[model samples]
Target: MSRLEVVCPAGTPAALEAAVAAGADSVYFGFRDGTNARNFPGLNFSREEAEEAIAHCHRHGVRAMVAVNSYPQAGRAELWQRAVADAHALGADAVILADLGLARWARSRFPHLRLHLSVQASAANPEAIAYWTERAGIRRVVLPRLFSMEDIRTLVPALPVESEVFVFGGLCVMAEGRCMLSSYVTGRSPNLDGVCSPAEWVRYGREGPMLTVRLGDVLIDRIPPGDKAGYPTLCKGCYRVRGRAMRPFEEPASLDLLSRLPELMAVGVRAIKIEGRQRGRAYVERVVRAVRGAAEQAARGRPLDAPDLRTLMEGGRATEGALARGWR
Candidate 1:
């Protein structure tokens, strides 16, 4: 088996150390502002914090990939541009980006810096992947989580750029990084603003036995006493479809593919990305440790001893998700 690189998340400088110490091959994070996809308040790094994180990762022989993944809003392209320049200046191993304009600008500005296509682009097929690789000079494409192991096995061999797949963490029901679910409700587009279900707009209330959940003005879901009250993202919420209330799109859960390491390795994927940048250091430590061990076991032809990371997850349950070609 190829030695699969474990790409973990680092919301802060402490999480960066925790991930590296837990045996990550690399760590991915973004700036504190809207320059990244996980722009939650109190999370992410300042320019000085980013510099420290990168230095720490390099000292431990791990690469640090900075995320400048959000699309630039009109007339605010300078913020995105500065983010790319700062990441390169700090010696980040790569910059994970989504916008084509930003990608082109960064490629021209920093020819030596590695550019990774963020999953927001959702370029699953060979021809689409090739567009980024041939034109923008992206060294790696963070493959969308929409692909199954079979799909990856078929796709990876055809691509020239290295592939990084999300083996574990939050499962996006729609094509990743591309969805406007949050924007439809709150008017804050995650693709453009780098936030999902922005906390200011999320409100929860209990009307007697029914738990009323609202994302802005829309009533997203109502759950009874015994039902699970998931964090109210529009996609994962229970919704009305054909006069029945059920999760037509997705259930609230994360993706834990600990058991599928060998299959992923066989498919020629160079790295496994764990998705969660707004989480704490403890979450980063636990997940990084578990995935690192799993990668090592897969290298030795041994089964991965599953580590229960549900406590570290959002709603306490996780699934194999589309990596198993999840039921529609």
Candidate 2:
């Protein structure tokens, strides 16, 4: 099996330093504006910060990727255009993108710059991936959460570009770049505004013994005092159906694929991505360091005796998610 690249997330400068020090093969981040999907308060980089980030990563012999992944509003293409240009100018190893217009623009503007198809594009299969690769000159693709280990084993050999899969952190239930659930209540789209539950619109209050979280006026989740409040986003929210309360999308558990590292290498994945740009340096350090060692173990064809890292995840629980299909 080939050595799998350990791609990690870096939301801030401190986290970027931590990830690079922890042995990340690559560190991905976004601009402070709505150009990237993880556009929460105090996350992402300014142009000056991006310059320093790329330089620091390059010093450690690690690649740096900039995410300009969110869809641009119809008339406002310049902001996204500038982000793509700056990523290339700052010597990013790749610029991750979703919008067709933005992809087209990036390729035409910088012919030699490497382009990565974002998970937001949801280009899972060969046919969909072919369209982006042909039209926008995509060199690598971040696969969505829809594929299982079996599906990935079957799919990677047929794709035209390098395959990158999410190996750890948060999970998304909806098809990327298509969800409107957040906008229905907060009037801010993650696809456009780049925040799922905008922090300004998020409210936390007590409903007797239960703690209630709402995005604007729409209630997202109710937490019994000691429980973890998870993400305060709609994807993991529990609601009543026919008087029975349940989480219709997915249960409150973070994605943990550490044990499957050897399986991923056997399937020929070029890179493994970690999905937590909204997290802090401690989380980045712990997950990246653990995953780096696990990848090395897997590369040697040795069975992985890895930590589950459940304490660092949302809800302090872990699941393989769709990797095992109907998992309990």
Candidate 1 positional error at 60, Å: 0.8
Candidate 1 per-residue C-alpha lDDT over 43-162 given as tens digits, one digit per residue, 9 for 90 to 100:
899999999999998989999999999899999999999999999999999999998999999999999999999998888789998999999999999988777777888999888989
The C-alpha TM-scores of every prediction are 0.97, 0.97
Clashes (backbone N, CA, C under 3 Å), per candidate, total 0, 0
Superposed model 1: Cα runs more than 4 Å off: none
Error of model 1, residue 241, in angstroms: 1.2
C-alpha lDDT values of all predictions = 0.88, 0.90
Clashing pairs in 1: none
What's the C-alpha lDDT at position 312 in model 1? 69
Residue 170 lDDT, candidate 1, scale 0-100: 85
Taking all chains together, the TM-score of candidate 2 against the true structure is 0.97
